[model samples]
Target: MREISLDRLRTLVAIADCGSFADAARALHLAPPTISLHIADLEERFGAPLLSRKRGQVRPSAVGETLVKYARRLLAEAEQALQDVKRQVEGKGGRVRLGASTGAIANLLPRALELLALHHPGIDLQIAVLTSQETLARLKSGALDVGLVALPQQATDGLTIKRWRRDPVMAFMPAGWKCPARVTPQWLAVRPLILNDSSTRFSRLTAEWFASGGQHPVPRIQLNFTDAIRSLVAAGYGAALLPQEAVAPVQDPRIAMRPLRPALWRELGIAHSAEDIDRPTQHVLDALWSLRLR
Candidate 1:
């Protein structure tokens, strides 16, 4: 069987809606003969007269009513598909897969998400908490669209890593402890320390900072989650070094945040495939960039 053309379906729908062939032709900017031919073709295909004249106004025959009902749904679905494609092209709707650390997602990404909601509410971000290395690997393997990862990462092919933000690594300790104006490697080394896992890039970076001051001390415990580490610090388990977002207003009285004396920093980068970036991903990137520190 031959497939029906969209033009005929559109004409039929318009005529049914307008209640007259002439009105439908005028509404569709088509000739009267074209409208008549559309109904004739539809009736011929289904072997039934589709429209009838009743009380000087046009109406659908019983068979025509059934076909028109189906036609309306099919046309509505087609229109919805067209609109969805247009929204994607306009950067107004689609899913953008992204990866970031728990710290970034907690303290940093909320502002970016707010901006995204205000501007591109139609775009959904699928977030995964992942390490810098895992995020980079997923990006290269085409599993993710964007990534927020620790800085100084080794270069990977087919990926572009843009500098995103730099946050100072601050000492988080129990508020009741005797504190110094600035925590140093020597001061922190002697205390029980909670730090990121040895497998993490930030752990290695912090280790290097300690090594700079001739202090190579093991942490009391190691874990990757930043919030949990902060909790341990509040309980006086030890002082942990972690990044503080400059704009974050800390009001927790259980723990105090102090700057590091040697000026250690936790840097982050945005990674993506070095290809023509799609609009949805680009919008997310723009939102992330809005949180850049200086």
Candidate 2:
């Protein structure tokens, strides 16, 4: 077995950077002979010349260039690991990977993260945007530390679920369309609709809402984004059923948002692996809970 040394790789990089062995030795505070021996050791290990000299300048050979690229990555990862360990020791914090459905991300996550940032500056949050079911699936698969998902969701094994908030679904129509103050599903079903995509739980909930009124109107357009649905409604394409939070931030004058007669609501919740709730995940969850309280 051959041994490849990081010291040799460092010396190789220094030589390439300084353009000469003597300069590299001076830069690394090593003797010139020691630097030469390091390069020689690498050449012997690989059975190839690792560098070439041209007009009194030094650079990596073709194979050496590839090795140097990998060396840089390995060194970087090692340094990062060291820093992570130090942070852990110092109680600086770690990373928490979170997943959320589109509605939750659009409405809830920014304020939740802002609260987290204020209280736990050392913790880093990694976010993935996915549908409610997808977020739960990923959470179960160990791909996510936590998820914000819409409920009345089916509870699978191995999850700790906590109720987050209830965002009422509203009717969005063209401005001055003369709809009732509280629109009924019966009234909404007769109109062409722009709805959430069929794949999402929101879309299913919307469909059920219309179904309860004994009507199923095919949507004129089915989209994944709430903002896009609002835009289409604003353009007079069709009416839409959307979460209140989705429209709360943007007050588009072209659309009139009305509450439902019975007030349809999308229940949202936080889910985590029942087996793994680390300190960072707990901290983020606490931040989210604070936002919900306010």
Candidate 1 on 79-165: residue-level lDDT in tens?
Answer: 999998899888999889999988898788888899999999999999999999899999999999999999888889999998999
Per-model TM-score versus the true fold? 0.77, 0.72
Every candidate's lDDT? 0.89, 0.84
Candidate 1, lDDT over the whole model: 0.89
lDDT of 2: 0.84
Clash count for candidate 1 is: 0
lDDT for 41 (candidate 1): 91
Model 2 segments beyond 4 Å from truth?
A: 2-79, 88-93
lDDT of 2 by residue, 93-129 (tens): 7888999866677767888778777877888899998
